[model samples]
Target chain A: MTASTDPATKEPFERVVQAHGDVVWKVCRGLLPQHDAEDAWSETFLAAMRAWDRFDGDRVRGWLVTIAHRKALDVLRAGARVETREDGPPDRAVEPPGRDLDLWAALARLPAAQRAAVVHHHLAGLPHADVAALTGSTPAAVRKAASDGVRRLRALMTEEPR
Target chain B: MTESTPTEAAMPTVPATPPQRLEALHRRLEAAATGDDAPDVHYRHLDSAVGGLLVAATEQGVVRVAFAREGEDAVLQALADRVGPRVLRTPGRLDAAAAWLEAYLAGRRQPFPLALDTRLARGFRLSVLDRLREVPYGERVTYAQLAASADAPRAVRAVGTACATNPLPIVIPCHRVTRSDGSTGAYLGGAEVKVRLLELERTGRLPD
Candidate 1:
């Protein structure tokens, strides 16, 4: 039977995961605070594994990180407390330098779509072209959202100490 | 092929940006990408029983599963960089990953059933990977076979290239792709691992 049609012919996928687990975790940790990082880490690798067959292995690392980053954002959007889940979200610190907490808070306050564009480009470090692919949007639209998100962040971060 | 665009100018300089972290993350991920016993411990803790985590996504009804713990950081960063920082990990998203992995490792499962996240690849490479997934696990195929499956029968060399650059390995089962002479070809996870996987399907042994 052909590989595609034969069920028994599929190779084991765990081997690849055994190969790159740590790389997945660091991406989750970087985006998430200690609290919510683990779940994000797990979700990232899991997502990568499920999609392994269709993945072009040329840039495996890039591919995995992209999934993890998106998954982290999904967690944040759910507003699920980090502690409640296996991979919990990090708690907001009392205060962060440069109004970091305020920035995230403002980001959280913005529309989910806008927040995603800003975070992916500014914090995640993806190129615009790649960003376009991930978000299913045109490069022009991604650029606009990023600009708007940044403007919103700056406004929230630099607001008069009211 | 390796040029940076001018649009990068709009990006700001943040001291704590993910780039530095991604550099370190990439090294660990790449090292871990090699299918060796030792793995990067900086972030992921591997337990063979759990079978490591993976993410499977697809387009056009074909799925690719990428198995790597180290790439997790990179995946998250890619999402953040590509999509947005709003990326958060979903709860129990790994259930499917863990289930398929466990079953595959225990020999209880064959034919990886996964969803594909083909957000990155475009064009021909994507088509090739889709076809690669159809190549059965135990049965080996020549590069010529793969090229033909994709309706590009003459592109045997291109088929080899596509297999070499597959982002997802086992899920796509590129290891099943062998030389025309029936000899084992190179595998990203190593020839031994490839042999072992084949043996596992052929003899049901854990292949030495």
Candidate 2:
């Protein structure tokens, strides 16, 4: 049978996952802590795979990012009842150590809205409008949060010894 | 903020490198996509006497077997389109089918206990494939004979069509059917593969 004969078929879902995986992870990392980010990332993809048939293949990246945004929010909401350690250098010191600890530590210090704005727009390359929708803010607000987050991140990264 | 100015200049250099955890998370996502904990379609490439074949299976059984010429990516796309998009490259899930194919290609002729998903064919075409399985090993049947066995004697051409489009080719033994004039008809695995499979069954070894 000719490949074009089937209008019902779309590109394979695995390719979508492979292509957008890192971006989804970045979005999750921007919103949640490392462990929770990974969980959200996994949940985003698993949910995507389940709903893949109904998804419009043309906007795969945006759809995936939206799912990731929602999944990350779900993770944050679930953990809201639990008390996290206060945000400070000494408080950050107790986190399980790994490479880029400083980078993640800096990220962890930002207000949640600013962090999401920076991660979604800068790292994930999502439009300010999309980030705004995900974060429940306007595009202009998203831009400001990203700028403020970056300014704070610059301060935080420089304070840490190389 | 002057001390942080240098860091601000470098701030644009947020770790471009993805953390190791992302890769680990991707693997975990793939695992969960194809895990036995869920109902999902699993696929993988297999090397055979013919060439690379993309084999797919669901919880029901072996569903689609596609030759390399058809494109593994295309085959998977079709599966995603036709079947659920829950398909993933899960080699471990195909272990049973692989074992059966390995033994069969090694000239063992072991019957595959795996269930066949015939959703790819329907109506008379589906009946033709079902009839093809009883053709017996080391024996040949004409397209006309296959059609007659399916109780559609006038549909010899339809029988050939069914064989050509058989989703599960080698497993279904469509290679056992030939032209009424004793010529090898078209095969999804190509003519050379058809010849080699017939020779293997006839002489207990592939042709040199």
Query: Which one wins on DockQ?
Result: 2
Q: Which tens-of-lDDT digit does each residue in A1-162 have in candidate 2?
A: 344334366566667767888778767766677677778988898888777656654677888888998887788788882312323454256444443566666777788787787777777777789878877899989878877888888788778666
DockQ of candidate model 1: 0.04
Residue pairs with backbone atoms closer than 3 Å in model 2 (clashes) = none
Interface RMSD of 2: 5.4
**Per-residue error at A13 for model 1, in Å?**
25
Each prediction's RMSD over C-alphas, in Å, is 15.6, 5.6
State candidate 1's TM-score. 0.40
Q: Global lDDT for candidate 2?
A: 0.76
User: Residue B25 of candidate 2: its Cα lDDT?
Assistant: 79
**After superposing candidate 1, which stretches have Cα over 4 Å from the reference?**
A1-162, B1-46, B49-76, B79-91, B109-112
Q: For each candidate, give the interface RMSD after superposing the true interface residues on Cα.
A: 13.7, 5.4
